[model samples]
Target: MKIRAYRSYFIQELESIFGEDEAESFFYLILEEKHQLKRIDLALQIDLTFSENEIKVWNVILEQLKQEIPVQYILGNTSFYGLDFEVNKNVLIPRPETEELVDWIIKSNTKDSFSKNIKILDIGTGSGCIAISLAKNVANAQVFAIDVAENALATAEKNAQNNKVEVAFWNRNILETYDLEEQFDIIVSNPPYVRNLEKEEIKKNVLDNEPHLALFVEDNDALIFYKKIAELAQKNLSENGQLYFEINQYLGKEMIGLLEKMNFKNIELRKDIYGNDRMIFANR
Candidate 1:
């Protein structure tokens, strides 16, 4: 059948579940991925057709979409910080808010400003988005990442190689590690910060499909990863080093207080483009 007619049916089928705008976006993303057709191509050439086999594939994807699986997972890859990354059930899909976190780090430190290669460590480095982005953008950055899950680390290592960035991967649980390999010029994390009580706010696409191990923490200890990473940062960050986090927006005040108590200096809590307090930077 002609692509436009199928597109109409696709949008109609998903509009109630994802809303019209989102459903349309998903259609175009799949179009580009599967058929190499952009939205403008569809507009200019409305007579594109999918073969029987292609339509069967689209039907499988369509059903997955109806079940509210993330389109990135359906596609098996995603873009972050202008780089492509492989993603799956093992890693949290990188978010735009995280791109902002990465931009902040890249802007603050550049190779031209440093006399030597700066070392960075990313704790709970799901998908290695933060570390790899830094290694790619920040010149002279020797990046390292740590994650508890071996499979997640494997995915992240694959991302690093695909991005052509040299990042050392460590398969260690940050919460259990007292000593870092060495002092780092910067330490960053987007650790699991969502509390159990807040699960209701998560979209079904995320709650149902994304890895819970990379998403949730007990309500009573939502800051557990932060506390552990902070303690390690205190011990392992070089003089005048920086620490960054993609934090729980609701706990900005609490995060600031935690850094203050840890005696970190020049604490700055930043909001993402949506104006939620979503990231923080502190100095040693």
Candidate 2:
């Protein structure tokens, strides 16, 4: 079948589930992932045909999409902070907002007159996206990451290796830990901030397929992870060190209040590209 002909069918099948533009985007994403052919390649070779075997593979992917499975999981990988990471059911797919958080850390470090050998820790490091990105971007960064799930830590370890950056991975639950063995110049976490009550606000594709442990907290205690990480940072962060978090968009004021109550200095809440209060920074 001609690839162009297949494109119409693919888009029609997914348009109801993901909007027209997103469904169209998925087609090009799959095209590049499966055939190494970009949209321009398909346009130039308008008569490009798919073999029966290729069509079968695409059909299977289409069925999964119908079930609201994330395309990143279908591809088994995703790009974040200009780096590739392997993703699965065990770990959350890295999001663009988290990329902004990583960018903030890198930019802040670059502007500061800190020593080259900086220690950084990423709590609840699912897929190790933040930690790996920081290590890759910040020269002389010593990155460490911890996750409660052993499977998540395993995935994060592989991601660290795949990104060609060394990050120490630990299988410890941050909620239970009182102290980190060493002080860090920077501490960052994109922990589970999605409250249980906010599950309806999440898309079906994410709510149905993403790992819940890495995405949610009890609605009554939405700031559980944030509070614990901040408390630990108070003890383990070096003098004048920075703490960063990708927070729940709805809890901006509450987050600021928590930091203020903790006496963290120079606390700032920043919005993502979508103008949502999605990240926060505090200095200890």
Candidate 3:
């Protein structure tokens, strides 16, 4: 079928399931991934054609999309902090808000006062996005990452290797241990923070397809991972070490209080692009 004509039908069909914007994004993303054709390619060559085989593959992906499967999973990878990371049902597709967290870590460390040769740890490092991005940007810093799920760690390790950044990957559940066996200059986490009660707020794409172990927490213990990671940081962080978190926006005040109670100083909470309190940083 002519790819140009198909794009309109595809977009119109998906518009009922997802709004036109998302459906359009899905179209472009698939076009680029499948045909190596960018939006500009389509604009310049409106008569581009797709072979029958290519159309078959796209139709399969379209079926998955109609079922609300996340496009990253369908594509088998995603970009985070400008680095490619492999993702599947085993890991959460990196989100824009989490990108802001990476930006916070990168920008915070850019100040020379943080010192070269700084040691950093990324707790619950799904796909190693945070750790790899930090390692790539903080040239002099040594980065390590920990995750409980062996499959998730395996995926993260591949990402580190693919991104050409060295990151120490460990398979240990943060909730079960307080000892990192080494101190770090910075400890950052974008841990599971969405409360079970918020399931309705999550889209079917995420709830059905993303790994639940990396996306949710009990409503009664929404801060469990944050509290535990913070506790470990209190003991494992070097003097003046920085701690960062990609937090649940609703719990900003509560998270700051938790950090203060743990005696974390220089505490700050910042919002993401949507103005939700999405990140917290503190220092020992």
Candidate 4:
């Protein structure tokens, strides 16, 4: 079958679930990921053909898409901070905003002086995106990741190996922990910050598919992870160490306030490309 005709059919089929523009993008995303064919290649080479077997496989993916599954989950992997990470129902898919958070940590810590290496810890390190990215980028840095879910830790371990970076993975619920046992020069997390009240604001794909344990908290305790992690940072970070988090955009002020109450100095709340108060960095 010619790829164009199938692409058009896919677009129309998904138009009801997503709008026309989104459906178009989603179709091309699948095509690119599955076929390794660029949009320009498909457009310029109108004679491109997909085997019947290929169409059958794509149909299954299309069905998943129609059900509002995230394309990254359907693909079973995603790119995060320039590395490929295996993603599944067991772990949250890495997001571009989280990439920005990783970039912030990398750039912020690169300017510091260390004795040939820096010790870093990533709290709630689902999929090991932040931890692995930091390990891969920060040469000679020792990175550690902690997660409560055994399955999540397994996935993150696989990601660490796939990325060819050695990260120490630990199983621990960050909320219940008082110490990390070792002081870190930098601590980072993209932990659960979404509030229960904000569930409706999330898209259907995320609300229905992603791990809620990594996404939400009670509205009254919106900074649950931030508070706990900040408390731990005060106890576990080395002198002049930095703590970073990808936070709830709406709770930037709240996060800063919590850090200040803990006597965290040099606290900085930074916005992402969308100008939302998306990341916070502080010093112990």
Candidate 5:
């Protein structure tokens, strides 16, 4: 089939689910990932045709998209903080909001100009997006990441290697232990902050495909991970060390209150691109 003809059918099928613009975007994304052809390349060769084998592959992906499977998972990799990360059912796909959180940490560290080696830890580091981004962007940063799921840690380790950054990966449940042996200049987490009550607000694709262990909390104790990480940071952070979180938008005030109760200083809550309360920074 001619490429443009196939593109038209693909977008029409997905438009109801993802909207016209996004459906078009998905076509181009798949073209690049599956065929190494960009939009411009497709445009220049409007008469380009797909072989029967290629059509079969495209049909399979289209069926999955109709079920609301995330495009990132369908592709098996995604761009985060300008680096490629392998993702699967075991790990949550990295989000743009989390990239903003990583950018904040990198900016703060660069501005401080710490001459000594900087130690950093990422709690619940699914896919190691934040940890690897920091290690890649910040000079003199020694990064370590922890996750309870051994499978997630395995993916994260591969991500670190793919990004050409060294990050220590540990498989440990943060809720059950506080056994980090070294002090860190910065500690960060983008933990499970979505309360069970908020599940309805989540997109169908995420609810259906992403790992719940990395995305949710009990509604009654929405701050569980935040509180635990804060307690561990209090003991493990060097004097005036920084702590950061990519937080649930609905719980900003509660997050601030939690940090205040924990006696953290210089607390700041920042909005993401959508102007929602999305990240928090505090000093230990």
Candidate 6:
């Protein structure tokens, strides 16, 4: 089958469900994944074709996309913070907004600030994106990641190994743990902050397919993870240590108030690329 023709059909079938632009993105992402053909290559080689077996595989993926399954899950991996990560139903796909939080951490604490033994902890480290990215970019850093789901931890561990960075991955529920094994120079998390009430705003691709345990909080207790993680940071952070969070956009003011009431200093809330209040930083 001609790849060009299939691309048109693929985009046309999905354009209704996920507008033309997004449908085009889905088509190209699969193209690169399966054929190693970039959009430029497809344009140059106008006669590129997919083998019969390859077309069968693509048809399956196309049907799945019709159900709004995320393309990352269909491919079983994604790129985050310039590193590749494996994701499945067991772990939440890493987001670009979370990558911004990582960039902030890396920029602030480069090799200059990291001693031979600076410690960092990532709680609820789904897919190990943040922890592994730090371990890859930051020098002389010891990284640890913990998640409640053992399956998620397994995926994260594999990502760390694949990224060629050393990270100590643990299966621990952050909500149940009172204290960590040692103080860390940096503590970060992108825990479950999406409120149940906000489910209406979520796309079907996420609400239907992603792991809810790593995504939601009760509306009345929307700040549950932030409160607990801040408490843990208060106890487990070194002197002048930093705490970072990928926050709910609507709860920035509340997040600032939580850290302030906890006596965390130098609080700062930053917006994501989309101009939503999406990340927070504080010092203990």
Provide the TM-score for each candidate, comma-separated.
0.98, 0.98, 0.97, 0.96, 0.98, 0.98
Which digits, one per residue and each the tens of the lDDT, describe model 2 over residues 138-188? Answer: 877999999999998899899888888899988898899999989999999
Q: Which ten residues in a row have the lowest lDDT in candidate 1?
A: 109-118
- Which segments of model 6 are wrong by more than 4 Å? none
Q: How many residue pairs clash in model 2?
A: 0
The top-ranked prediction according to lDDT is: 5
* 1 against 4, candidate with superior TM-score: 1
Stretches > 4 Å off in candidate 3: none
lDDT of 4 by residue, 1-284 (tens): 99999988999999988999999988787788888888999889999999999999989999999888999899999888878999998899988889998887777666355557789999898899999999998866999999999999999999999989999999998888988889899999888889889888999899899999889899888888888888888889998899999999998888888899999899999999998999999899
Clashing residue pairs in candidate 2, if any? Answer: none
Q: Residues 76-174, candidate 5, lDDT per residue (tens digit)? A: 999998999999999999999999999998988793588878999999999999999999998899999999999999999999999999999988999
Q: Which regions of candidate 2 deviate over 4 angstroms?
A: none
Model 1, range 8-47, lDDT digits (tens) per residue? 9999999999899999999999999888899999899988
**Candidate 6 structure quality by residue, lDDT tens digits, 123-240:** 9998999999999998888999999999999999899889899999888888899989799999999999999999999988899999999999999999999999999998999989
Each model's backbone clash number: 0, 0, 0, 0, 0, 0
The model with the greater lDDT, 4 or 6, is 6
lDDT of 3: 0.90
CA lDDT of every candidate: 0.93, 0.92, 0.90, 0.89, 0.94, 0.93
TM-score of 1: 0.98
Prediction RMSDs, each to the true structure: 0.8, 1.1, 1.1, 1.3, 1.0, 0.9
Worst 10 residues of 5 by lDDT: 108-117
**Global lDDT for candidate 1?**
0.93
Instruction: Report the lDDT tens digits of candidate 3 across residue range 1-284.
Output: 77789998889889999989989999998888777999898889878898888888888988988898899999999988888899988998998999999898888778575555989999999888889999999858899999999999999989989988899899998899969899999999999999988899998888998889998999999999998998898889999999999998899999989999988899999999998999999999
| Model 5 ranges with Cα > 4 A deviation | none
For candidate 6, the lDDT comes to 0.93
lDDT of 5: 0.94
